[model samples]
Target: MKKLITALSVFAFLGFAGAAHAAEASGRIAMADPGTSTLTLEDGTTFEVVEGVPLDGLAPGTEVTVSYEEQDGKNVATSIAPAQ
Candidate 1:
């Protein structure tokens, strides 16, 4: 019983560690380039939209929240949504 509890605790800790590496930003779109599949925030932070993460219908001046992860020294957006 104790061993099982310890294993579960370790798995939970690992999950949290993965989540810690992710980040979120909410702001208006400063620029969006469909040709490049990239976008920039109003604050000048740039993000590369990951494969399967939809950016359709979004345009400059649209407010959105992006969930991203840092990879290759760049922010890669995992998901994006209109800001509520």
Candidate 2:
């Protein structure tokens, strides 16, 4: 039981370490809109503005920071918001 627990802990630690590195290597963008935001990343992009979340007050040329992640063999969004 003790050995198994130790192995699992190590695995978790390594996974977290890898994630930290991945985030650092990723690119970041910024947005000017406070109500709505959109960011373009590597192979994928994130957009918060839509029919539901309209960019009514958002100014043009607003940049959004986003990160990319692979999911089901497709690049997907990690996070997106006004580049702060």
Candidate 3:
């Protein structure tokens, strides 16, 4: 039963971990550097768009909402899109 308990604990931890990263709209992007795919938020925050992100129509000076996270103590943009 020890192994079962450990497996249950691991599964529960993983489930809660995903719930912790619940997509949230932190703020809006005000400036974008499509060359490097870096974005500047309205709150004066800058983000490094991860490689392979599809930023087709996203351009500089476009207002957008971002779902981000703090991973390894650094800002990580999970997803971003135009603000409603």
Candidate 4:
């Protein structure tokens, strides 16, 4: 029973740690470099987009909401969409 409790505690902590790495931001794009799969916001936050994430119609001055996770000290975008 003690081992089971310890395992559950570890799993819970791991889940929260993973959740903390995910985040969202909304801002106007300062630049969109499809060649590099990178997007920079006017506020200077940069995100590296993962493959299969569309960058269509994204350009300077376009407002967007980005969902990303911090991976290897870089913001890796999981999704990108126009701001409502």
lDDT of each: 0.89, 0.46, 0.70, 0.92
Mark the regions of model 4 whose C-alpha exceeds 4 Å error after superposition.
Answer: 1-20
Global CA lDDT computed for model 4: 0.92
- Cα lDDT tens digits, model 4, 1-84, are 999999999999998787746799999999988889999999999999999998777989999999999887889999998899
TM-score against truth, every candidate: 0.72, 0.30, 0.56, 0.79
Ranking by lDDT, best first?
4, 1, 3, 2
Please give the ranking of all candidate structures by TM-score, highest first, separated by commas. Answer: 4, 1, 3, 2
lDDT of 1: 0.89
Candidate whose lDDT is highest: 4
Candidate 2 lDDT, 1-84, residue by residue in tens: 999999999999998767632131234333334344443444344443323443344444555443445444434444445665
What are the clashing pairs of model 2?
A: 29-65, 30-63, 30-64, 30-83, 31-63, 31-83
Q: Looking at model 2, how many pairs of residues clash?
A: 6
- Top model number, TM-score: 4
Give the lDDT of residue 18 in candidate 1. 80
